[model samples]
Target: MPARARLCATVPALLPSSEADLPEVFGLPGRRLLAQRGDSALVVQALDDALVPSGGSVRVPAPWPRRRGTWAVAPDASLAVFAGVHAVRAVEPSGATRWEVRHGCWYGACRELHESYEEYADSKDHRYPEGGSAGFSVDGTFVWAHVRGPLAAGELGPDVVDEWLLLDATDGRVLGRADAGAAAAGSFHLPHPSDPRQMGLSIGEGQDGAPLRWGRWDGRTLAVEYVEGDLTLMSVSPSGERLMTVTHDQDALAVRDTGGSVLEGLEWAAGTAVPRHPDAEPDNDEALPYWDWAGGFVDETTLVGSTVEGDEEWGEGRHWIIDTSGARTPVEVTYPVTVGPQPPTALGDGTWITPAKSGEALYVWALD
Candidate 1:
């Protein structure tokens, strides 16, 4: 049977200062939400009784002027890294600087990390933007960082290559490094929940979404794993038993073992049954469906899928719970209330977060 969803709690979301892009959700182990938008962010957490800092706590500032790159909070929520165009700077929760690594500019034309956002954006060599990202290990011992290959002037040279490094969080020492030989238009870091030495890097290839690079650091060596085609890694199961992703072009959702073998899969293009809905289309509701680029496995046995926009039947993009464990088929999750537009951020513990920034709150929905 399909699972029933309940609005268990409501919390504030980190809204951008002005008219800006939607915030990105970073799960901070203790049911916290790091809704980061551009250069600054707010960390709102789910507490035992209610979501934390109802008014939004201190702002996590970016090293640069505007939010041109990505940022991540350490596991303890004590430190944050600003992976700006020129360098990666780690700062404490109180805004005190810990360490900074000056590197090459991801934007080729830029000579250095400018304090002015316009100077870097307008003077960039490539039309597409370039930036870096960093994340702390699950145990907080190491920091996995990605940046445009370092240069003396912070600008890309004749032959620039992207670099990924494993750093010692305590001293900013490079533990391991690899050169990503792609001219990536953009990139971000997807953290592994269980392992401290492993993480995933997704690099954008312009019109072709992005390709993922799986990295593992075993004290001495850093292994960069790639399948050479479209296997954009999305959600790494909570137990680390498998990885789930919607294939290139959002054609199919494929689950793979850690060793890189397909276990079970589902393609949305194949006509899916319209779960009985009161507001479904009049007739011929069954049609080709597309999976959201962001949904994930609700648990070991269930996969929660979503779409950018829902049809007349599912309302504004339906959230489907599929029994990928093979014992049963997919079920359309029934929500007790109206859900918002952005894809659901699966917490992997029978709970997920739906951020309705426009509504100025986050809906923490639990499955029953």
Candidate 2:
């Protein structure tokens, strides 16, 4: 029998512009932050235990347009780091510049550290430059960043095009760096849940492939271990022991140890593990379901995932609660209300979230 999910809470989306552009809810160790973006600033607000917005929000002046890159808010919501085209800039809530680290331009052919976003803000070539990302360590004491290389004034050859940096989050000092060895189209940081010293980087090379890199910073040196290409690091388990990942083609999902060895995995096979949608046209060829490139652990031994993208045309999306402790198969999840096409996002607190039909709120669910 399919497991059931109960509605636990509904949190409104933070919209800085239109309703469709809701800000993302960033997951911190035990807290969550809604990082909303605006024309020239970002609003960082804390989420209460129930996932509702709580307390005052911090507005940090953005160094460039929100589309130029991504930003990470400090654990305390006091600082915001912008990983932009030409630099990684740290800004405070009071509109003050804390520090900046200029790096090689993300624009493939541009080599100048132009000093300001306005320099190439209107240039056609800079319109869609590839970008990098940053995130704070679990304790907020360090910032792990992925950037196009040849870091400002650093001793490195042109061949070193991309680098993962460990910086002192408080002062923006470069503590250590490691070559990413990727022609990244983009990337993001996944901070470990318990260990401030460890973090993950997932680099997307568009259709080429995705590369996952795990980094460990021990105060003096930064060591990186490369996982196989084409895997996107999704989330770390609550205990910081296991990781969840999906293949680039979305055909497989896996649970891995910190060392990058797969401990358990599941794949989709037509009319078997994932049968054809009942609502599919009777005469239609059998459709194979692929896992969504999203989802995470609800706890140490269980997870919530979806075949939403693969099921969309056939009917309403399908979600599941998979046992990672041993069974290693997906049991469908029955929701109390209609869930959207977006995959379920596990909160690591025995609950998960799905966008409501209204597009302005999220419905949190727990096992019924």
Candidate 3:
């Protein structure tokens, strides 16, 4: 089994401190503040204005006993927390709290929000025996979740059945639920660029012969749209105007307009390959595709990604700048550290923030 790594807790200097009783601190994009008092994590924001903790501190209740998961920050600066057995709560900027109407089901699942950072829950009737995963809409208003289903009387091989669910982020209401039948493994939620109420679902095999399924959700309804290859990496553009997905054998990044129509398709260079990092374990199935780690869009035209070449550790990881103009090239940026997870996110001003795992430190790299 792959060793588990805990997320670093130390807050970087760029991130406001939780120690002082101060109201707020100015950081990169806005004024940020954090408070941890009486079993709650409070996040406050003041952007392009005077910093004040009095107006925006969101107090999140503590997790239930025996289970724990990570917390996610929404695009609008809200807090989405999964408290094991308790509930998933969305603490809004106005300090309003809304609990998942359906609780006690998503006990130990990977929960995340759309851009709005509202709360959502995956399918609970069918649970993944070992690990759980989920995805959200771009606006944070909707979610699509998958859970492993029960086995047959004399089943063989890994659990072959699974379930898919569409949820309303506003109230934890189950909008639609479906049993994906056998050979179904995982599902991802991709938001539409122009429509906040619509999202796309990508379901596929986990490791072996699991079938890949694709569908669309229009808030009030769910429908299977396409069933194709085994999808590996899936991402939607920041503007919610485009969707990009990659399969195992071939890679094609398709651009879809707001109407769910394919506008253009870019095929990855046939000979290019993702390289394996030295620290990755030999049996790690998740490590196969290097492009899986490469995501984030600087704009509608400029997309940033990481590329790996071979099993042998050779050159430093390459950053590729891709665009609709059809030219792909590596941009030069110095990576401060050579070890650990190297996930990078591009900031607004031609710069990127890569957080270090060991400490409360983040390296700001300016792209020249």
Q: Please list the residue runs of candidate 2 whose C-alpha ends up more than 4 Å from where it truly belongs after superposition.
A: 16-20, 28-30, 264-272, 281-286
Q: For candidate 1, write residues 189-214 as lDDT tens digits.
A: 77777888888777776776566788
**TM-scores, each model vs. reference:** 0.82, 0.93, 0.57
Residue 105, model 3: Cα distance from true site in angstroms: 8.1
Q: Taking the tens digit of each residue's C-alpha lDDT, what string does model 2 give over 318-337? A: 98888766676788999877
Clashing pairs in 3: 115-138, 193-240, 274-308, 275-308, 275-309
Clashing pairs in 2: none
Best by TM-score: 2
Give the candidate order by descending lDDT. 2, 1, 3
> Once superposed on the true structure, which residue ranges of model 3 sit more than 4 Å away at CA?
1-59, 62-128, 134-140, 148-160, 179-190, 200-205, 209-215, 249-265, 273-290, 308-312, 329-341, 346-352, 357-359, 363-367
lDDT of 3 by residue, 1-368 (tens): 11112222223332333332222122233533333322245443433422223353455443421122323333345545342222344445445666442222322353222222223324443233232234455456665555443211122224334555566666756676555553433344444544555555555444553233444665566665444445443455656656555555433434444343456445454223333454656577654434533355545555555554322254455444555565443232344344224545543234344444442444444434
Cα lDDT, all candidates: 0.66, 0.83, 0.43
> What TM-score does model 1 achieve against the real structure?
0.82
Q: Model 3, residue 366: what's the lDDT? A: 42
**Preferred candidate (lDDT higher): 1 or 2:** 2
